[model samples]
Target: MEPIPNPSSAHPITEERPGEAPIFDWDWTETLAQSWETLLLILSTFWCILLARVVTQKLQLHDSPNLCYAVEFGLVILPCILLITVAVDYSNYIGFVMFSGTLWFLRKNRVLERARTRGQFDLGGNRHMALSVLRALTHLITAINILAIDFGSYYRPYRKSLQFGAKLMDTGIGLFVFTMAMVSRRTHNWSDLRRIAVYSVLPLILLGLARSATVLVLGYGQDIHEYGQHLNAFFTLVFTKFFGALLNILARKDLHLLPLGFGILLIHQFGLSFLGVSDYVMNDDVDRTNFFNANREGLVSLPGFVGLYGLSIYVNRWMVASSLLSYSELVRKLRRLLLVVLLLWSLFVISAYGIGISRMTCNLGYVIWMLAIGSTSLWASFGAIDFVINSVMPWESSPSDEQEKGLVTRGTVAKGGDKSIVSFTISQALNQNGLTFFVVANVLNGAVNKFLRPEDRSNCESVIILLVYMFLGTRMAYELLKRGIRLA
Candidate 1:
């Protein structure tokens, strides 16, 4: 099946009145508190993972796949959706989760101690699974907020801005690009670049074109300032990929990717700050008569994304190496990841004071902000998943031991060894077949908007609709996994 263009940014939720203003024409992005609050919402998901691990282990839920998935969905996925859309006071929810998790750990302190002393409890599970979890959650959250932002129940402060600010929705695109960079790293030769341009880059451009055509033909309401007159997220992906590949060729093999990435980011930052690119892009008064002016947001934002792409490549390289490490080695790698997060966050704090965090323009602060979020998210997932596996498996029969005993084999979340870790399986399915999941999500998002009128719905109705949509989309991903179908 031909994949549907993702409707994340091209949403047509409500009709404009004759003289009514555009829905996405907000003056500035929401405040740091709002963005941080929403960003910290991921902690709820981490809590869910930890809690679900305990519940499943206690009940021996992995004996039945159906029952296991049901528990995971109820505990991990459902609450994540709620936290993103309807729930307020996010810190409270996170705190409650932490308290509950602490109590459970305290009760199992003996088991944990025995496991740790026996050299069994350690952060040595599959790092690849950790990366997959991070990617899946990012995709899932972006999918949820894209539709939910149109609803009355959804927080208005989470909406993307036309000009500037670190809003949740706009941050979604940057996060997506950052993950793409992490996953799509390569040392492209001339032939490889040509092949990538044809096989990889061409399809993304076509996808962008398809979305543009779809919006025009279906008469979906579009905000020109979001990606300017004709571009969309796919185009941004293409630009980032093109530039990243071109730069890789220029850098050759000797130069380290991290320093090269930093240089690109510094140059981009200079252009945005010292050079007038930021002013030109943010200036609404600029006439959209020329092609450059028409797609200024998409064009001007490319360098920052490319810089982000380079940074992710370096990080991903580190992750790939860490995947093969032992427990002690993995701990050192985790510390390195933490340092990366702290450094990026420190840079973001300093840069935002000067250049300001503008996801619209993809400014220096925004790049660091995204890199920080991406790294922090990956670190959290890695630590959490590793903790769950190490803490849970020592008490029960480890999957390896289970196989030796001829017992029911625990399922593996990622490739490599049989850790038999309990995780959000829906995320595994979605990560396994992301293109299919996103296509299904975007098409359904449009269908829901067309039929249900999310903006008019009550809070109760909105939550119900979002829950149903998430269930169906993830269920479809699971079904596709069962069929061994990867649409991309």
Candidate 2:
């Protein structure tokens, strides 16, 4: 998923010409009053975790671990379900509570608590499962946001009553990808870098070139994206993310990665500005509307995203470099996280007010704003959720406890985790299997567009279609799991 999609960005949706020019509203990113609801939602999400956790822990007389897991999962997932179903203004609030709470809950048991202080992050309880669950949730939410709406109108989306808020998938992907990357850190060696390059980056680059050729040569995506920028997200992963890691490995300077990347970005920004590629020359409607793959957007924006990728490494290094032993220790760590958030927020405010917020250029202000908001939300949401999970379920249930209670047995997953249709059924399907679902989803979406043509369908029909697609994807994941198949 390319972050901050332009109206005309590549991604096949039912095409409908607008009577009037479509408006791109971004006031909430600037004004405090307009953005008040979102800020409050962030707070409300954290509060939801606290209240749910505390209440659940206090009423834990059920004396059944399975019952407790079921109850906890329900309490956390309910708000998210409401948000996704209703859409509109409430989406961000519930989405935040859901992901952030689950993230914290997962972090309750540290796999490498002592190593964390020395700059290592090893989480307990089937990390692959955790990552899969989060990615699946992200994909699921994005699917609902895009597919379940009316294709008649970009905003209206035929029959849907509420529009999804921007804050949902726009920022969610960044956090999860970074979380995934951070968990799998420490491959600065050349052999490992080359292995990733051959196995992942090169394949992605080729896929991107093929996708780009669909537009540039065959004229598939000529309506929305430009020839150059029409290359798919695989290009983003290969060029922006993997390219950065390759640079670090070549330089053999892992510690100084972000600073170096930032410097490179600064040079690119100024170089683009000097070459008439800046806002001065390309301020026209065609340029703004068809910003994808534009020379400025397609080429120049790479450094910005790469800078963000580099910064994620640095941020994750600091984040997982330490761990908590007690509630009081968590409180201290949280305060530190908040302090960093405040400082970053100050920088974001300065950048937005001083320069401006431009998603097109992947401007410095926009990047800072993303980090500031993402870090605070992740920290606060995760900490609170972890607290509650720890209170309800022991981080490591003893063999005796499991044997006596006949509960969720030790190390259920031989490779991943328990295959039972338990409390985390949907998440388990997705856990460590998000990519397969994503690829399946895209292929199926294209097939749907070809056959069903969602643009012609009514809103009710579209929603039903979306449900079918989702069910199909989930079933695919489940069957794969049963057969011990995985798409990493």
The candidate maximizing TM-score is 1
Alpha-carbon deviation at 378 in model 2, angstroms: 2.6
lDDT of 1 at 295: 92
The sequence of per-residue lDDT tens digits that candidate 1 reaches over residues 131-231 is 66677777778888877877877766566754555666777778878777666757558887888798778877877777677677556667877778989
How many Å off is the CA of 236 in candidate 2? 0.7
lDDT of 2 by residue, 1-488 (tens): 11324433221122234653322323334233323333444444344434543444456423333443445444444433233333435555555666786567456644234323332222233242233333444555545444443244223211111111223333333444444444345458778787877766676676566545543543323212211335445565567657667655654555686677677667755654455444432333445444542544445556666676676666666554544344455556667878989997787667645544443455565567557756765575445334333334323323443333322233221110221212234454555466566656656665676668777876456546766776677667655654456554
Query: What is residue 51's positional error in candidate 2, in angstroms?
Result: 12
Candidate 1 vs. true structure, TM-score: 0.83
Candidate lDDT scores, in order, read: 0.68, 0.48
The per-candidate count of clashes, in order, stands at 0, 9
